[model samples]
Target: MIAGISVAVAVLAGCGPLPELDGDPTAGKDGGAKSDSETGRGVNPLDNPDGTGPGLKVISSDKDRAKARDLIDKVATKGRGAKTGYDRDEFGYAWADSVDDVPWGRNGCDTRNDLLKRDGRDIKYRSGSNCVIASMTLYDPYTGKTIDWTKSKASEVQIDHVMPLSYDWQMGASRWSESKRKQIANDPLNLIPVDGSTNGSKSDSGPATWLPPRRDIRCSYAVRFAQVALKYDLPVTSADKAAMLEQCA
Candidate 1:
């Protein structure tokens, strides 16, 4: 029941150039198989309009940065609302696979696994189940490092909602239907796999308060934040929008 297309497998084949490493544990191993930046990792947000690809690639060109800024400019801005009635449950159970109207909905795999499969390279599935990811090599765009991940050490890698759920709640999702809320929550366009600690630190903060620690990826991250806001007809706090623009500036 996994919906949409199967997770892109090019990552396993090392689709693109390897990212430069500085003390990356997975670096220099197996001739840098683990460091491969392929499989759409580091994809420009402009090229990846739907967000079903791998990691956020750095937007380095002047033209691309201008494009990123243009996208960020289109995102409407307002003050974030109070979190008066927000709750995780308001968007359906975390990672529920049965939610309707999202890319991977009813796909027989939970959101977490779908994302893990989407972003991880050399992915291994549990015995007799393609839906459960046993292990994989993940290039964490947030930190610009590669991770050799296994289910047993699950916290080492965590799925990040590029537009966090609580932030969404404050930014107009509070008035959305249950189904629409669920769609935004599960949408691949809004998710990425990154270091667990980094994800934790982001904790509901928008671009103004937090961003990926890796400076090179900031422009791409800003584009992603704006993309999600535009897709859902949500507005960011003026401060958040300004911070997003600064990343590309």
Candidate 2:
């Protein structure tokens, strides 16, 4: 990852786009931390402020995604060491499946509120609800930018599965106990709130085939991707491993 200071320099040098500052200047960065403008919350990090010249762009293709998914499934079945399946619990279904039924949960996690809490700036719990996150600021780690958390624009930022669940589906997860599957689905280590456009572009892609548009982030992204795959015992395409090694080195 780029040092926080280097990120600030990227923004100042017009290397990247300036993030939208949508919350109180007093509120801190990263959604929950206390804010101070002097600490660089409102800064831009791109080498090009105008967003010209090789800005971040995710590759797109349904065909490639399908191939990736198939590759994951094949490797997962042939590979050993992954949890065979998710363990079921008293809830009568997998953790991920149960959360789907929760009134407030969305997208595999108690997603709506989980993200609200994770992304909101001066977030408040919805009235009388501990499970609900009322509001908070969103700091997009992918681009080193911040955004306001108004309901209208909420979709602009989404909680991305750093290692996509679909990718898991084809991998060892297909054989996982539903309960274990749920844990991976909801695990904080597997999630991040990033720009919707970026997340869509990344859909189910691995390190070798895809990466964040922010050039400064390749190292950290590679590290995180490796850690997650290793943790879950997920299989990686040879290209994926190579991509991660190249970036991390």
Candidate 3:
């Protein structure tokens, strides 16, 4: 579960061994993207429909917020259900790339490294393997902190699920197919690499109960939650939907 970054215990859920890659990891991939700080401030969700784009940038414009609200309004809502029969394993072995219909799925690298490459710049890989990211400079949207993180202290940077799985279960995902669970679990659109401590604090919370500490990033965060909900045809709680709408308003 290298794709499975945790706030506590510092271990991926069901993490598998790192894969070995030939030649340069970025060589001839992603339109000849450089190894430097290539993804400037990230991409706005409104323009990044497929989520092949890197990073989650803030939604600042009035027009974008208007569009965000419109997008959010499409989300269905109901009161949350009981959290019975919920488990991490329900999401398909935590970030297994063997799953399909996802952006970076079966791309030879795991979901976690794919996201690290997508969001982090000034990247470095494990000694000989181009697939394992050893270190990178991450611009954490949640806390507005730039972390120069190394795999030696892998827990320092965590991949957060914008709409947490537990929250999803309480909403309606408990009944979804196993593949759908894995899709949401590893989808880049629903993932963000942020300060580990901040991610730890946000464990399984929705917009109503928790949001990014950085106020400016909240609207974008809200829009992302809505995007995930609508894309999966999942419903959010009514209170959660209200809080999400408030951030953009």
How do all the candidates rank in terms of TM-score, highest first? 1, 3, 2
Backbone Cα, N, C clashes tallied per candidate: 7, 30, 3
Where does candidate 1 stray beyond 4 Å? 1-40
- What would the TM-score be for candidate 2 when compared with the true structure? 0.57
User: What lDDT tens digits, residue by residue, belong to model 2 across residues 89-178?
Assistant: 422332232443222345444654564554455766667877555455665656655555555566777777667776676666776665
Residue-by-residue lDDT tens digits, candidate 3, 166-200: 98888889999988899999998899888888789
Model 1, total clashes: 7
**Using alpha carbons, what is the TM-score of model 3?**
0.84
Report RMSD for candidate 3: 10.3
lDDT at 101 for candidate 2? Answer: 23
Greater lDDT among 2 and 3 belongs to 3
Better model by TM-score, 1 or 3?
1
Candidate 2 off by > 4 Å: 1-112
The all-Cα superposition gives candidate 1 an RMSD in Å to the true structure of 8.8
Q: Which 10-residue span in candidate 3 carries the lowest summed lDDT?
A: 1-10
Error of 2 at 176 (Å): 1.1
